[model samples]
Target: MVTIRLARFGTKKRPYYHVVVTDSENPRDGRFLEQVGTYDPAKPIESARIDLSRVDHWVGVGAQTSTRVRHVLNDYRRATQAIA
Candidate 1:
């Protein structure tokens, strides 16, 4: 199954994540189909970046998102909406 999830990166104590599309059986930071966004918890929630068009495309093709990724997307949407 294909899933949209976070691939952890960055040094210890300073976490960064790439929101990637990958197989559900793959390791968390293993091979991914494509990167659709980025998450940096060290910064404010509003600082996260996502390519919504790409996400929509993946969803249209039947990709599912992880729980945390869903929250991040919601938060990012709210932040952008608040600013616009």
Candidate 2:
């Protein structure tokens, strides 16, 4: 099954995440099909960036999103809309 989730990267104490699409059986930071967004906890919430068009396309193709990814997507959407 294909799934949408975060892939951890960055320094030991400084964490960064790439929202990616991959197989359900794959390891957390293993190979991913595509990167759709990014999350940097140290940055301001509004600074987080996401590619909603790609995300929507993936969802339409039956990709399932993790709970945390869903929350991040929601916040990103709201933030982008507010600035537009």
Candidate 3:
């Protein structure tokens, strides 16, 4: 099973996350199939940058998204549709 979740990165004091797709059995920071976005927790506004098309592709291929990722996707979809 493939899971879409966050992969931790960056220095000890400052952290960032890569929203990634990986096997459910893999470690949190282990082997991952694709990097779809980034999350910066420390940003004043709590920002995330994502590739909506890639996320949609993964969803189409049966990747089960984490709860947080689901929220992000919802926002992304709303924003894209509003623009379109």
TM-score of candidate 2 relative to the true fold: 0.95
By lDDT, the best candidate is 1
For 9-47, candidate 1 gives per-residue lDDT tens digits of 999989899999999999999999999989999899888
lDDT tens digits, residue span 10-72, model 2:
999999999999999999999999999899989976888788999999999999999999998
Candidate 3, residue 33: the lDDT equals 96
Q: lDDT per prediction?
A: 0.94, 0.92, 0.84
User: What lDDT score goes with residue 55 in model 2?
Assistant: 96
lDDT per residue for candidate 3 within 1-84, as digits (tens), equals 999998999999898889999998999999999999997767622356888789889889999998977876677567666767
Off by over 4 Å in 2: none
Model 1 Cα displacement at 82 (Å)?
0.9
What's the candidate order when arranged by decreasing TM-score?
A: 1, 2, 3
- Which 10 residues in a row give candidate 2 its minimum summed lDDT? 41-50
TM-score (all chains, Cα) for each model: 0.95, 0.95, 0.78
| Candidate 2 local Cα displacement, residue 50, angstroms | 1.0
